[model samples]
Target: MTLVLVRKLLRDVRWGLFAVCLLLFVFSAFWVKIAQRVTTEIAPFFNGVAAVSKINPKLFDEVIFKGPGKVSQAVLGGAEIRFDRPDDFLSVELLHPVVVIVTALWAVSRSSGAVAGEIDRGTMELLLSQPIPRNRLILAHLIVDAVTIPALVLSIVAGTQLGLALIGPFEVDYSVLQKLDLPPMVRLPAGPPVLEVHAARQWYAVVNLAALVFALSGTTMLVSALGRNRWRAVAAAGLIVIGMFVANVIGQLWDSAAFVRPVTVFYYYQPQKIWLKENWTVDLGEAWAGGSPMVEIPVMPVLIGVGAIGYLLALRVFDRRDLPAPL
Candidate 1:
């Protein structure tokens, strides 16, 4: 019976799922292409800058690295931007504002319709009249998430691989004569070096992204369970996601607001950090250690816990609340 409900729900959302998967796949490939262009174009310019800056130590180290570089770092989650590793460059795309918002919107759209949407459409009475238990209904929706979120993430993975294949491995171009204002025939001595993108390294961040989607969907499901209108539920969940995202960004840039990060789900959505880690393990003891979001709190587990709690609360509320009369 639950299987039937899950299948019906999947059929209803299949088109929406396909659209999202296509969008994610295209965006992922596009970002990879952008990274490749940066490698080919910007790499030489940066090389020229460093070479010329050798005449004035302050130009490279102080003016560029510490000045504008710091701002870029803060905005991109506070890690030094490493041009040498193209994988790091690719990972930056995953953390882009567009990617974050799209994934959150997917969650908001799906979860918001679970309960509140039915009630809003005067279909909750009809749905409940079926033998499907309320818990199973929610479970079926969760099952939908389990299927769809991976399709979205895997689309990104496939797109990235496709882009990487198109670009081939990184090769440094020392042909800096045209890009810089150096004396007529001067050529660059060295170019940036990079390793091919590894499947495992990318998976680390992919898992983090999945965990983020899970957290958002689960949290929004609670909101959906509480409201009667799907749009209101969407607005509420969307606001929460935007608020947390803003807080996370601000917290990165400001010391005073640093305290607010851990409480926001975005704090755990560190794709770059996870990509750079040498090892992965979960430690509950460090969940809130040092009152900073920098602590290693086992990203997947913490996020899953947040989602679990939200679902449990939604279940409890959903079971007890009475439905309004059909409009």
Candidate 2:
């Protein structure tokens, strides 16, 4: 029964899955170009700042500045490092929201007809006529849908990583050249240049993608179980996803309006704080010194939990529901 269920789902969605994987590869390649452009444009500004201050160029070139504060004379006297300019890690940070929206919409579109559409088309009755129990049948479908989420996400990650690796070195050198204060005549002895990629930020983006896919997939699955047809399920899921995005944008724009924050799923997804260079700071005095927005934002564990619970409830509803014959 489980094998049959898996086979049916694979047959139905394999082409769609292939299309999604291809799209992800394209986006991954796009990101590499974006990263290169940002590196080329921003690094020179920091280098110019360092040169004007007459600080050790190496320190400013490599070190990512977190914040601006007065350096104590004692610390300055003993320190070998002079000025630190924050790395403009905005490329990935800026791109995070786009990735979230795309992935959520994709998941919703895929899962919107998982169960209800089958029932509406009278295919559910044929499946149930087999030896498989209703509960087991619904469970099998849920499992198959759930597995696709991770597979899709990992494909995106792998493609992104491969693209980045290919272009990362050129970007790093371009950044260094843009930052160099010397005249065209004075060339520094070029050795093997060090490339520093923020692995943590990339991993965080992947985690965010996974969380969103999990949430949206669960939501659409529930809608599919409850909705009368594929069109209704898709509409409901699309409305929910779009509404969440709009609410989030409104909350961000009017952050002082405390009431709006709770309504936005965006409030919980703080990619800017986690990925941006300027927001990453350490304050010695407080337990949580850095004022990264992510720190203040409430985690959406409840949303995730509710989504999971909803899917289980949906399976139960689907198991008991009667399937009408097709016209």
Estimate the TM-score of every prediction.
Answer: 0.88, 0.70
In model 2, which regions exceed 4 Å deviation? 42-98, 170-195, 256-258, 271-300
Candidate 1 lDDT, 172-266, residue by residue in tens: 55555455566756655564455466645777788889889989999999999999999999999999998998887777666677667778888
Winning model by TM-score? 1
Q: Ten-residue segment with the worst summed lDDT in candidate 1?
A: 282-291
- Tens digits of per-residue lDDT, candidate 2, 226-247, equal 8778888988888988887666
Error of 2 at 95 (Å): 4.7
lDDT of 2 at 78: 13
Tell me how far the alpha carbon of residue 112 in candidate 2 is from the true structure, in angstroms, after superposition: 1.2
Residue 84 lDDT (model 1): 44
Q: Pairs clashing in candidate 2?
A: 65-85, 65-86
Name the best candidate (by lDDT).
1
**How many pairs of residues collide in each model?**
0, 2
